[model samples]
Target: MQTYNAPLRDMRFVLHELHGLDALTSLPYFADLNAETVDLVLEEASRIATEVLLPLNASGDAEGCIVENGVVRTPKGFREAYDVFRDGGWNALAGDPDYGGQGLPESVNKLVEEMICAANLSFGLYPGLTHGAVMALSAYGSSELKDLYLPKMIDGIWSGAMCLTESQCGTDLGLLRTRAVPQEDGSYLLTGSKIFISAGEHDLTENIIHLVLARLPDAPPGIKGISLFLAPKFLPKPDGSVGPRNGILCTGLEHKMGLKASATCQISFDDAQAWLVGAPHKGMQSMFVMMNEERLGVGIQGLGVASAAYQSAVSYAKDRLQGRSLSGTKRPDLAADPIIVHPDVRRMLMTMRTTAEGCRAVGIWVAQAVDLSKHANTEGERKEAADFVALMTPVVKALFTDLGFEAASLGVQVYGGHGYIREHGVEQYVRDARIAMLYEGTNGIQALDLVGRKMPAHMGRYLRRLFHPISNFIEAHRKHEAVAGMVEQLERAFGALQLATGQIAQAGLKDPEEAGAAATDYLRLLGLVAMGYMFVRSAVIASERLAGNTDEPEFYRAKLASARFFIDRTLPQATALFLAIKSGKASMMALEEAAF
Candidate 1:
């Protein structure tokens, strides 16, 4: 079995080189964070990931989680690991300082998340969901709610869950049947069932706070009538101690395809005592705060697992002896050369490497944009940052996961029969990454949102956020001799994305179905362009670093190589996707309802 190791060097390269640390440090809130401080934080986080979490991954997978007598019990060693995690202040890495948090920049914490996911994704879910829950509560929860729940949840004495999907509803929250009846004491009685709730029940925390979406008794039908509520598993007493158990119960634990150790529960709330987080009938507005961040978190999850699988594949290729190289006998003393020497094997390796690295850059860049959106000094800077984030969030969520699953499957392919076997662990990456695309509004829904909502948002303001950066970068570097070929390739791909975006937007106005038909491919096309842009940015940085005779020449050289692979191979797919987006909805909508 290949044990997980945090790719600290690559993480540093992405953070400090491609997306500068100064971006975060420039903010007044992040004034204390410099390269050295960030490096120390990452190093310590890497230590925990490699040492504490990695050792328990396979064990947890094998043991899974057990639900008995209404309480969920996580796999062996999970409780202890989480204790260490919480005590290490890992839970509050990017939390608010007012509530006993570290108050770090989100971009810094994003790398920590990637490391956790790569090391042990099942274990990471507990804190991952908690972080989202805290975001919602901090943004919209009443002062009382925040004073009571935020401190414990942020400190990890209590965990949290987002309860939105019910039995009859997934993406369509309008059809939900959950009801929150108003109480005489100013709270509500939440009576509903939320299905597929991650981290819904666990023994790792003293209490569990649930951010549920439900409807008021007097509410009109559909989404507008829906409201958000904060319900706890154990109600707190007047002294702030754990009191009586609330009405919420983990009725059952889901038998999943992957992340077996992460408890996904079917929660039943029979008149659960709850408090409203925001204004009545404004639940969706509050929930979007969590949803958007969770979307980015899901993308990071995909990147993490794919990175693990890629590392596993690379490690195996270097060690596994196979037939002689097609070119010649590279290892003359041995009967067979390693599979890595084969051209075909190298191609697969390059695909995994380029995709994983390119996606990392893209994900981190978005993370930086998120920090700026929240903390930038001026309104112009903040809105510009927000626009970029809105445009790329769907692309990151959909494309990163789509490519992640592909990369995981490629790992299985690279390992051949050994990959399918459980002990090797590459297959687990595939299984775990499979669900990211389905949850968090599904990749299909994300594509629809990108085409229908985000592109047309503020009369094309969001789309322009993406377009301007690439256009500016291209114009500035068009004459640079070192990267001329790469720039030319990126320019063509950027044009493809522009054409696809315009055609989809125009087609959507005439018939919404046209946008739906083109959405998935269009999102992928947009993702490729984003990846190209990141590659170009990285290449330019690497080119400058190499010119300075940096201490790490090989590192910069490998970055340039990855960029070349992305431009030459990956960027070409944009043309095909652009053509597909322009193909119209005729073939798609031609069939009748029963034509299948």
Candidate 2:
């Protein structure tokens, strides 16, 4: 069976040692937080993950969710588990304090989110969508709406879902046909059918608040006419009690390859009453806030699954004795040696380890920027942090998920035939991990956003936020004795990234197709370089700790080893990606339309 124990030690290393807690506490918003408090929080979260959530993962997948008589029921025990989760205030860990949240920084909350996702991704979806809704309402909703919905949502009494996709429209909102008519009392009556809505209808909460996108009666055609509306499963009375049911129903539940415990619903809205969120025709702007946050959350989901898969793979590797090691029979007392002793097995294990750890580090780095973007004292500092967050969003979303799926697949390979069957539970990781690459603005779209929009935004101001820091880091550490080799690799990769950036900028301006063709490769190149940067920095920190005679020598040594593997085995992929980008859209777009 698959088992997940939160990597709390590494999380601590990332939070305290790599990205200093001091820097976070320096911000006024996180001023009250200390290392001790953070450690306690992490320990408790780990307890919940192991005790409450992890046990439900396999069973939940087996049972899935069911919808009968327009009511959706999550897997057995999920409601109780959710109550435990919500009562503990896990849902509002990083929400606004004014809305009864703990107001924790994203830096800490993201690590907690990773733990939740790792333990049970389907269960995590319940609160995950709610958190995204809370963010959107907080950012764009009017005072009355926020007052009415934010508290209950943030407190976990209610859950939320994003309603944007339709049968004909997945990526192109311009094709959406959902319509909203203004009511006399200033509310809007919405009528639409939405598909693939995760956590859209579930019995876990008292009410499900849906942020729907529809066009006003007099709205323009295409994407420009789209508007965001807040439609709840049950309307709230004046005193915040659940009122009459709205004109929304879950018509059907999607049967999927994975995340079965999460209700992916076919929702029918028949003249549902909704309030406008932001201005008319500017729905994307408000929804993007939630989408961007969810994108990051999805990236963390990838990391979470990868981490769980790696742990399960490692456990199986150490326990499953296949054949004698190539070197010799290390376990002579047994029939054969554990597979971990074999070089090929080691390769797969190391790949999974390095990918998960590297993504975790990069996630934390971006998460710190998220904190700074909101809590920084100076406007310039906040703007710089925001730019960094914006530039790294797609990278985090695409890179983490792509590599996460790779790691999960590798886990299955490590488990051999046993991995393919449901008995071992590793196959579930493969199925669950696949979806992360497709949702929250598919990785392809993420790459295009990185290349087409963000790459050229404000004459490449966003690029500066990333490139300058990495450039300075490489230059400063080029001659450092402890990590000189890794620094050298990072510098070379960064050079390739720089060249690719310039090429895309110049070539894309002349021919957009060139940029379109190179988008995916270019995004990978940048992501690899960013991860390489993190590994090099981690090595430096590990070296310092080892030199100082730290007690946790094995942990530091493992960090150094993972860093070396990333630099030696993984970072070199930058060369191939760069070559692919340099090749441009010629051979890619060369084939005739009828060739396929």
lDDT (Cα atoms) of all candidates against the true structure: 0.91, 0.93
**lDDT tens digits by residue: candidate 2, 1-596:** 78789999999999998889888799888889999999999999999999999999999999999999899999999999999999999998999999999988898999999999999999988898999999999999999999999999999999999999999999898899999999889999999899999999999999999999999988999999999999999999999999999999999999899998999999999999999999999999999999999999999999999999999999999999888988778998999899999998899999999988999999999999999998899999999999999999999999999999999999999999999999899999999999999988999999999998999999999999989989999889989999998998899899899999888888999999999999999999998998898899999999999999799999999999999998999999999998999998899988999997
TM-score of each: 0.99, 0.99
Candidate 1 lDDT tens digits, 390-422: 999999999989988998999988999999999
lDDT of 1: 0.91
- Report the poorest 10 consecutive residues by lDDT, candidate 2: 21-30
